[model samples]
Target: MPEPNKDEWEQIAKDYDEKWNYLHCIGALDSKHVQIRCPAGAGSLYYNYKGIYAIVLLALVAANYKFTLVDVGAYGKNSDGGTFERSEMGKRFESNKYAVPKDKELLPAMEIPYVIIADEAFPLKAYLMHPYSKAAITSDEEKVYNCRHSRARRTVENAFRILAGRWRIFLKPIETKPEIADLIVLASTCLHNMLRNTSTNISLFEGQIRMESEHIHGVANLEPIRRNFVREVAITRDKLKKYFVSDYGSASCPWQWHSIRKSRVAPRRVQYYLLNTRIRYNRPF
Candidate 1:
């Protein structure tokens, strides 16, 4: 492969690699489905991830260490992991997206790469991997593979924490012109990167207040996002080594945060209902 040029390759290297220095044998990946009020005369073509009509924001994060952002792909309704893979970053990074260059020195190589954490809903691709199912493999091995993938992939969950944690914009349903949705997403990401780069020295509590005020939502009080982040982290760490082996069927992926909604009929049922749901938690790319 040719040597990296300072302008182009250096930016790519920074965006793809050094930013994720904390990650190990894991990559954080997930998707966030945001509600966008549909346009007039449009059917439910944008309806997705959930029964409701909305656009889904697909994101990737670095897991295996400190939580960090990798990349994000935005799409309309009816999009799944397969659908989001149509994004430029997804096509470029996914092992199955294109021919894998034999030259290991390519960007995919220079870093310490690993698995991606995903829920049962996502289909498994080679580099963007998942766990074995009871029907697909022995239960014992399935749990083993799952636990390994979970550990490294939780970073994306944490990245979502940083997002909803700071930008309350994601806390509610967002509505805009279909074409403008991607731009809003890009703006959120730009702010995220900007804040992430600005060094901070405030105390924990002070910092918490600052973020809450800035993002406009007290996400720390949002029990579901908080709980899922913790729950997924635990699931990812148990018996992890087994999933890391090459001979085994396990794989890795670019990671992101997943946003899921919970439905309830009553006030009491609302809190409990939202908390018990398995279907939605922020999943990343």
Candidate 2:
């Protein structure tokens, strides 16, 4: 397997900023459980909260629907965040081992660190952004912030959908040992990216993206295990939220307020429905 070099990471972030109107997004992170038969004598170690025996496939996807990095074969019994913290990449990131680019400003006098987006299952680290807790979103600014955050973060979801669609093996339980299943999953992911790169047929992803914009699916909110452990992360999120409501940010998408009003949903749950509505309020974002 190839490592994601600094050049590739920078290019992914640049494309995300240009194509998704989400600036400085290095990647979107998420995990999926590859269903599998219980391993011999494992004693439910592979069983997950979803009541299935499986192995976890954690991936960081680039803006172009390619896998930037992947770690497979964690027991499904572990939470996504737990699997991530134990993954080699995750440990390296925590220890600052990767050649992450220097921090850049989102706007003049507003230096914001580049970040990866994830759902509430993950910790809100200095380099990561997750939606605000559903119970604490009390202001319109937070709502808009959540909307924009989810919008930008949906790339990984789409990537997973495309991946599973292309490789139906993931849709069914693989009757193999855990170690072999890991290799299968890795090979399938590599083929997925190969197909994406060599093919120009994007109709499948395009249609899926359109449907995603029209339907707002409910995401289960998993409370963080640790609270008040990362105050700087929260402060950074606040700054981004405030920016979303400012004239400079709104200038990129002047129609955002209209879109928000039309959606008429909670801030954390509004991004999907707000996309592609025929209200004629279009802007770059």
Per-candidate Cα RMSD to the true structure, in Å, reads 12.7, 6.6
Total clashes in model 1, counting residue pairs 3 or more apart in sequence or in different chains: 34
What is the per-residue lDDT of model 1 for residues 1-285, given as tens digits with 9 covering 90 to 100?
122233432333243333332123334567766667777777767666567656666665532122333333344564455654676656666644332222122222232223344654554543445544434444444444444344434445556656665677777766777667667766776676566657465446445644543232111121111111233333332323333333322333222111101111258777576666633664331
lDDT of 2 by residue, 200-239 (tens): 7767656777477435423334363445655766877887
Residue 265 alpha-carbon offset, candidate 2, angstroms = 4.2
The C-alpha lDDT values of all candidates are 0.45, 0.79
TM value for model 1: 0.53
Off by over 4 Å in 2: 203-206, 210-226, 265-285
TM-scores, each model vs. reference: 0.53, 0.85
Give the Cα error of residue 77 in candidate 2, in Å.
Answer: 0.5
Please report the TM-score between candidate 2 and the true structure. 0.85
- Which whole-number lDDT from 0 to 100 does residue 236 have in model 1? 34
